[model samples]
Target: MDDPRDPRRDATSETAGNDDFGNEGLTSSDTLELEFREALNLANWTSGNRLQELGERLEREVELAARHESEMAPRVLDILRRNLASAEGASVESGVFQLKPEIVLNALRNVLFNGLVEASDGTRVTVATLPVTVVQIGVCLTSYSGDGDGGSIGHRLFRHDIMRRNSAAEQDVIDFLGRRRRRGMDTSAYGDDDQPMGISDMLCRALMIYGERAMLLERSERPWRLGHGGPMPHELIVGSGRKEMAFASLEMLRKLLLDHKRFIFVPSEISDQTVVTIANSLQPLQYAVLRDTTDIIENYVQGSSYERPHYKRSGLYQAVRSFQVDAGSKVLLCVYRASAIAPGRVFYAHEDHVHEAAQIVIADAALQESRGFPNLIDIADRTCRGMFEPGGLSAQVHATLARSGSPFRFLEERRTRP
Candidate 1:
């Protein structure tokens, strides 16, 4: 489709084997950046201009970390597979819960901060979902970057080749883009706009603006890596917020977000297919859905009755938004969509609503030690609802007593993948 609003899924490069619009052939120099900058300017969105500015700053990041290239998608999926696999490490058996706590911690942390992205509206150019948008932008740009030849990670990310192989990583980008998208609800804005961006279009916009920002953040701030699966390298603290207002550590942040039986974070990174593949590799964890909520520990205890109906059933057209299992040892997680707290309002709406949700897998941990329990509550403070990437690692995980000690193995599930 020639329309700028269209995703240009069929927009092949004029020259064979070129993906960066045509800048793939450009020599590595100021010339290449300028060429790409002009191409993004023609993207016909306000975010495009911001992307052009970002291109100037991102050159250094590309030069320094050229090590990360086309194989980006696999790294993300591999982490998911290993972390969630029941047979490999953790097993819920004989009613005793055991696991390598570090593995679970890493998986949860990686998904929470790294997987999210931010997107600026094409119409108003306002940034939305800060870290998540940048992550998506970086992933898309990396896909378009390709290898020296024509092949790119996009082939692996957006295409079905990986699934056809019947491999461990069960899903691809296109499937994720289709199934995991967060659409505009009728109750909110974008109700009557001539064109409201789909999940991919918003991703494309993020590809323009936040992609550049992520690259710049990588070089200037010097963020470290959780692992190869993460979207961008992150530093301890990157913003100008008070340390008192952030999460004490990754450990505490995990506890706060997953405090409930049902939650909805952004599962922007891991696909359900990957969860199934990991489930297959595991011996103990059973991947099953709630047919009628009989197995749940509790019913929808909170939220408005409209969204928190007593009955939920997965269907051909309508289905359970999550797949959950008791991973033994009292660890129960549901990658679910439910009426959650509102954002940017700065006030807890007495009424609850389950607006639009996909599966954002949350990390659940019931721990005995939390030194800064008073401080850890800052993460969900209703005062700063609009704050972007609210309370990042640097601010949240400071060097003070707020930081949690390395968790000892509460219980180790002694099982290897068969």
Candidate 2:
């Protein structure tokens, strides 16, 4: 028989084993020793007023952030007003910005009940209970190197797929799956950098190229291409690339910033502090924190070097205007936090259209298990992962090289660690 109140028995039990000491029971003196060591280790840091000083320092940072929001909000709003005024299709009411929660709710209500989503450009899409068409792009890469002074090479794969779902039937179309092999050091890349590019950079270029290609295919005369009306359907394109609208590379961002096609690019993740600050500033009284779309800030430069010669001379802006959209009722969806686009450069040209785009994203995201990300993109990502699994290409290449009777030992591991 075991004593239920025995601490050592509980600690040693298979189902209730202790994490730190395992099944070993600690004596009173051993516990005292641990406490003494902990106190000794923290003595200097916990001594005088160190904690108070640290708290004060953190509070100062918070205060600075608050002050930054206060000073920057008006400047950003002024820029939006100026840009809207200069745009060709600017309305008389374009200067007025909507910051209230009721306005957003009204828009959402109309979308849910009226079943008619009217874009600012007068493109009215009759809403079904679900998306009539869904498009998603996926990309994956694997790299291999000769076990010598020779450089590495990379193989990349990209897939563009569309799914049509309605009451009648559901159909899937794998439009294209592109495959490319490139030297790791190739510098004739998208951005035209003079320096040799790495395998990771090659992967980024693949994503950008694949995304652009997907868009091109969408506009093609294929029977299943999007936005053709009559027989062809209208759909939103989702990408499994960068969480930011910028995608992975700058050149693709430049094209997206300059082109005004029927598209919406939303970042699946939000990490930029400036974007968070913008969301915090315009947070409305009705919604939970940072759940509403923000007033657009035109020509939003991403990094600090917007004034540099490389960017300024070519007018290449890495970042465009962005808005926050928290689709989750109480918590944030894991896939994305916000979306952004070029000012006056996308088909969703005006604020109302941008808001409509956000609403559409929220609606499609609701149908998926993730609750916040579009299902088609998630499906495409999974399909790509399944098809182009890690090391799958590498293993085949290594086997082929082995059978080719290469003189050099090319498949040797560079480094090994325990």
Candidate 3:
């Protein structure tokens, strides 16, 4: 009736008729856009949850891989154990083993550098991944220290004996001794004019300082103690008279044992009669008589029956002969000494054992050296050939030289030409 084709009439009719439902089309489109945005947000939330789940799964897999690797560690160690057994001069008895020089040398290298586990102390074990040759040189150097002058000459000559020996360690020993000498002037307590301290006294001081330092470096490192949980046997060689020194040494040792509650002093010179007397006197600590002469050790081995608790043996002679050139005789003496000392524990007849125990040290040194390895084979050849000349300094130098062929030749040529 309002004439739909007429613009003014149509507008007026539309406005009046639909005023309550105005803009219904625009409202419907706005509702649809809001629904679409809500759907998008939900999808995004689902994707985030999936990503978090994936990340957690990857972390678990990594942990599992590490665990599997750790579990396989022991199996890998078994291979090294077999290789050690087959090495030359190794004796395996009931799965227990003993190593001769060459074998021992190799074993040390394997443990220190080659990644072989030598021994464990609950928390961690010492591994040898170092070259065997390098360990040999370290042993040689340690032995040289026993030859007097604190191994200064030997250290210099053997500087290049190992390919990876720790130069810093060598320098440390040098610097420490140098500083000690220097400080003597500042402090009258350790002056040269002071009467030389007894060996036992010196040992006590050394042990205290060494123990403290060792504890600081490695808190788990334990002190040497006896079966009753007392200190290890230590003696002080005092005075020129052997018997007097022995008696004083024993008395002081006993006192230390009593005071420390963990030490047993093995007298360096207790005879059969004295051994019995000392055993009777000392209630808690075990006793061992240290014989200076070979005859005394032989007498105890042959004469003493199983009735005596204290063992009698020659320690000084064994220490000396263990490093001698004549292997046949020296080896025999070492065995004899070991038999007399203890049937069970690993008795170190030669300084070689010490070298074997610390084989990694040499390898570490070699790594630090310019040439990069300890020349132990050369050292052995030179030692066997007696290429090392003899003099006070020469003996020390030769001992060091004997541990490395290249260094020995270089030093020898230098000496000859000079």
Candidate 4:
């Protein structure tokens, strides 16, 4: 028979012969079959080379994907973990209400006048509710050199509020301040004289006032271990128009509360609207407004009947300056036209709660004339609103006072109930 697997034959014939011989004894056809097999092996080798190239490419792609995932996974996990921790920390236990650190910090910086709480074991806690409040206050003061030109205290306050609300203005102030800093000149143009108060000085003063109040409130015996306790209900006083003198009074109050470590002094700024709102909001908490715009003795009327009486007298500022001397337990001194009555009034309401007071100040029409006055009000208002919502600083103060382990008794003496 002709060699079926002959290399000279058609390729189909070689395939047929290989299938037919299948392990039979070697013949002339077997030699031809071996050559055919060699050709088939060469073709398989070439195809395998192509597949190997494709496999290598696939392997490289897989390695790249794995590397990318490896790089990104930790970051994603960390974010998720932080979120979980925050959520967990914010959660309140049944029948137990606790303030969050952010809320506490905000109260310290803006409303509470920078109140701090140091634990008995020497853990110092600075309460700040919104990080932006710090940044906003910092930037607002940074624009001023404590000069009269930046505007009156009222104008400065107003500008601060307006700028805080207006994003464009804020950016401008920041940019202007940044450029001034780079140029090594004064950033704030408004001041009493050319020797404007630096923003850093203002910030330091504000922070010092806040820290002082916190230290006093916490009743720390040691200077280094200040702010170890919470607010004392009996020591709290909420009023309006006593801004500047309040800081000085706070010095006295610090002594009063600390000498009696169990006592807490809380000072608040309230407007006519705030008085009514707080009265309505904090139901069952005894409410009274001392219309002491005249002499300290004349303003002290007795009974709950003295709801919203107007005082026809000057020196209301003088009376407020001295009001702290007789303030017994929590007192809410609500004044009408606080800005009109005392334009540059400075008071403390837990540094964190200052944002609310700042809001009130900024909203006053009188502040419009003051440079930078309106800016902080809007910024503080937005921040306070965002943080406390339906319940603002008043709510926070009330809650803190309640938790302060002091007996809160509102006094309404018929002889001294203005």
Task: Go through the candidates in order and give the clash count of each.
Answer: 23, 2, 38, 78
The better-scoring model by TM-score among 3 and 4 is 3
Q: In order, what is each prediction's RMSD in angstroms? A: 29.6, 22.7, 35.8, 35.0
Q: Which sections of candidate 4 miss by over 4 Å?
A: 1-198, 215-418
lDDT of each: 0.24, 0.30, 0.28, 0.30
Question: Tens digit of lDDT per residue, candidate 3, span 80-174?
Answer: 33453454333221011222234324534544333321111101111111111110111111111122111111111111112333669977667
Prediction 3 TM-score vs. true: 0.18
Q: How far in Å is the alpha carbon of 53 misplaced in model 4?
A: 79
Please, what is the TM-score per model? 0.17, 0.36, 0.18, 0.17
What's the best-to-worst order under lDDT? Answer: 2, 4, 3, 1
Q: Give the TM-score of candidate 4.
A: 0.17
For residues 62-181, write the lDDT of model 1, one tens digit per residue: 754333322232343344433434433232211111123343344335532343311111011222231122111122111111121111111001211112323434455564444224
Best by TM-score: 2
For candidate 1, the TM-score is 0.17
Question: Ten-residue segment with the worst summed lDDT in candidate 3?
Answer: 133-142
